[model samples]
Target: MNLLAQTTNRVPWQRLTTAYGRGTDIPRLMETGQYEEIANLIEHQSTLWQATPWALLILLRELAKQKPDKVSSKEVQLYLAVASAITVDHMDSQDTVGTMNELLDEKYLWPEDEDEDELLWEEEEPPGYAKEAFFSYYYFSYLLLKDAIPIYTAIMNGNDKLAPAIRELLLLLEPEGVSE
Candidate 1:
């Protein structure tokens, strides 16, 4: 099925529209099934995917404190594994892809509501290797979130330290660096 039909069929079109902005029929646009465009929109919309290195490190630190359990522990470990892979992949390709600064400038973030012409100037030109690295990073990061939400919901419902720990970890991963 088309992405738009899938998204609308799964989520309320109104809520998706409100969150993503109006006039642009995201669901309709996604009907093309072009993975790259879908990826761009996902990266642009989600702060979690764009988290800084330090923020991700802090999240790992907090997650380290949590006790091992059947579900949440496994999920957290899975996320960390994926994150580590992305990091390793980035590092290995550093020579060809240039530094993280270059990758961040080119492939990391997406533009906000702006005209194509304006976006052209604002967007960085990523090398082929850099684009590949980013695509790997984005795909795994997205999968991690998909795994986290259910665990988060369960933690929230339970009266355990797990919820608070996860909340702290998420706070650490917030867009703005942690406050002093």
Candidate 2:
């Protein structure tokens, strides 16, 4: 079974925040493989959102399911975009990771959305949970992306152009004191 199918219903996408607003549109966008739209909503301005991890996970899983020769260039481009988004230096800082881990221990206070038709918060200022949501989203996405190094290797093995970049991205994800 597809990981997307497994979590699509379980994750309260409507309640989760994205770069745009709510992640309510993620599933629909994903169904059509709209990589550009998905990337924009999940990681606008290089900031990862609450929906980023799920979107990345599903994309990786979908890539893993396909034969290397059968994978489309668009899909590979999306993979490259995701790798760049997660491995950016600032996002991997010790301070940021520590804060994300600390927040992970506390129960998340999801923002309430009384009206599904209306926006969750004003564009000028997001709700308080916004920061917490970013931390949580980034943390989980980092972990998920780190674990996906093997998948990255497998996908890029024979591809001369992308393999080196994937290796560099994977190096960034490696834990301290460990080298591979």
Candidate 3:
């Protein structure tokens, strides 16, 4: 199956909502399946929308499916953009990731059309179970990339624009011989 189809078919889009509206719109652009709108849709104010991983996982799974010899520069950079978003958005433990994680786990908090401003305090104190569910899935995304380091290095070799982002990801990873 194609990456866009794989993601849409697997992830329950109706149950997911972006700040703008329902997540149904994601597929219209993703049909191209070529890293169309990561910069605009996934992160805002330096935070990944809780809904991002649905789109992200499609790209990720596609990359994970590639052999290193077949990886292209665009594909590598697309992965970099995704990984960099994860790193930059998660950069400060107390800020971006912390807040986005909190939101991802929030299963039942939606504002009425009139209460547009109420989302602030609700996010600050999500129910405990929400936090648990969010982290469980968020960390799992790293597991998906364990074998893709070579892909990252390949992108770094030819693209200087992504060096800092690549370094941030490398630092988060355990070194080859280290044990946790």
RMSD of each: 14.9, 6.0, 7.7
Q: Candidate 2 lDDT, tens digit per residue, 1-180?
A: 122333433555675667777788988987888877887888776567766777777777676676655655565555555555554433443434343323323244235554642453544444425454555566566666766666678767856666666666666566541232
How does model 2 score by TM-score?
Answer: 0.66
Candidate 3 residue 27 C-alpha distance from true site, Å: 2.2
Tell me the spans in candidate 1 whose CA falls farther than 4 Å from its real position. 1-74, 77-130, 139-147, 177-180
Worst 10 residues of 3 by lDDT: 88-97
lDDT of 3 by residue, 1-180 (tens): 132223232444444544454455676756655454543555444344445666666656566555545545554444444444444223223322333234333353333232443454356643222544344333433433434566566655545766566555555544332223
Q: What is the lDDT of residue 46 in candidate 3?
A: 33
lDDT of predicted model 2: 0.60
List candidate 2 segments past 4 Å from native: 1-9, 87-132, 160-165, 171-180
Per-residue CA lDDT of candidate 1, range 1-180, in tens? 111111111222222111233213444533443323333333343322223221222233333344434335434433433333333223233334333223344333334333443344344752222355444344334333433444455554563645665555344333342332
Scored against the true structure, residue 56 in model 3 reaches a CA lDDT of 62
lDDT of each: 0.35, 0.60, 0.46
Better of 1 and 3 by TM-score: 3
Q: How many backbone clashes does candidate 2 have?
A: 0
Better of 2 and 3 by lDDT: 2
Q: List the residue pairs that clash in candidate 2.
A: none
Ranking by TM-score: 2, 3, 1
